[model samples]
Target: MVRSILSSSTENVLEKALGASALRHKIISNNIANVNTPEFKRSSVLFEERLAEALNETKATPARTNPRHLAGHNGGGDFNPVIVTETTTSIRADGNNVDIDAEMASLAKNNIYYNAVAKELSRYFSNLKAAINEGRR
Candidate 1:
């Protein structure tokens, strides 16, 4: 029972994270594509820490005693992630700050992490199916 619950929760978080990561990847790709364009400052996604903090806050909060109580003030499961930020560092002489090499590296790492999360989600579903079909085993 506990495993199933935890798996479901993890799957939810992974799904959200993957969505955010994919958005980041797209933005990064766009930045790289527009590296030659004039006045492109290279926006980036900034949600990993926020997402983790939101999840942690949700976990730390006690369950509400009232059914109609507003949720998510603390651990209320607000999963909406932000995906836009300006770099603190300066840009190139051409006013384009996106480092293609760095963005590509980040994309590769994010892809690997996304794949792992997907595999874990699949395993979780498969385990649930196995448990449900135990009678046939």
Candidate 2:
């Protein structure tokens, strides 16, 4: 189906990663913003590990030619990023767990990841458009 083609596995993966990166950006910013707040704990996103698990599962999973076929643990599309807040430990006397320097570094890294994923998706669409244009020629 056209919908299935448009939402291919690769595109789904990239989209999920992009979404995670965006969430990571917000989470890192929040951590930075709450660095001075007493008893405030830092939060982080958990996506990559779940993504990896799904990817690895896909390798051993048998292809299902029928829609009714039993599925395996390769449900990559179902894994969503989780926001986990640290409940213990602190870097200062205020019981605040946020580390300014670490949060800054995470912000930069997530920015780069988001940009790269966005660019890749843009490129994918561009190539698809080119193919469609060429098909008309």
Candidate 3:
């Protein structure tokens, strides 16, 4: 029962998003750290579109009667987003394109978004506990 609750859909989605964002954060930090390096193209994590598509995939038809049987279009499992490409958006004239201002902005936005998701997850767990306790009373 505990395992089932821990593996709930909400938890899975939140965990996947958090993992992806954390990896993106690491990549962004690396880019900032290497801003002064010559010939270094800025890398970025591209997972939004893929994540959205996976969220939309649902199996409306099932071949087997089993609950786990193939259903709604497969979400294609966990997101394995990779660094799609490097950008040459030059913010400087030295042939280097690492824009500190843009990177900071992105990092700040990502932090805020991640925090919001975490808060939501906390609230969800709290509500679940409340529901469980209410049933006992």
Top of the candidates by TM-score: 2
The list of candidate 1 runs beyond 4 A from truth reads 1-7, 63-76, 87-89, 135-137
lDDT of 3 at 131: 89
lDDT by residue for model 1 (1-137), tens: 88666555667777887787788778878877987887677777776777778878877777878989766466626766576656565578766677878888888887887788778878877887888799587
- lDDT leaderboard ranking: 2, 3, 1
Task: Give the TM-score of each candidate.
Answer: 0.77, 0.89, 0.78
TM-score leaderboard ranking: 2, 3, 1
The best candidate in terms of lDDT: 2
Model 1: lDDT to the true structure = 0.75
The positional error of residue 86 in candidate 2, measured at the CA in angstroms, is: 1.4
RMSD each, Å: 4.5, 2.2, 3.2
Clashes of each: 2, 0, 6
Model 3 lDDT per residue over 26-121, tens place: 988988898898766788887777777666663433456788765555663656667854664666666677888888998998898778878888
Give the per-residue lDDT digits (tens) of candidate 2, residues 1-137: 89877677878888899999989988998899988999999999999998987777777888889999997665555667999988977889889988899899889989888999999999998998898899999
Please give the distance, in angstroms, between residue 3's alpha carbon in candidate 1 and its true position after superposition.
18
- Candidate 2 pairs with clashing backbones: none
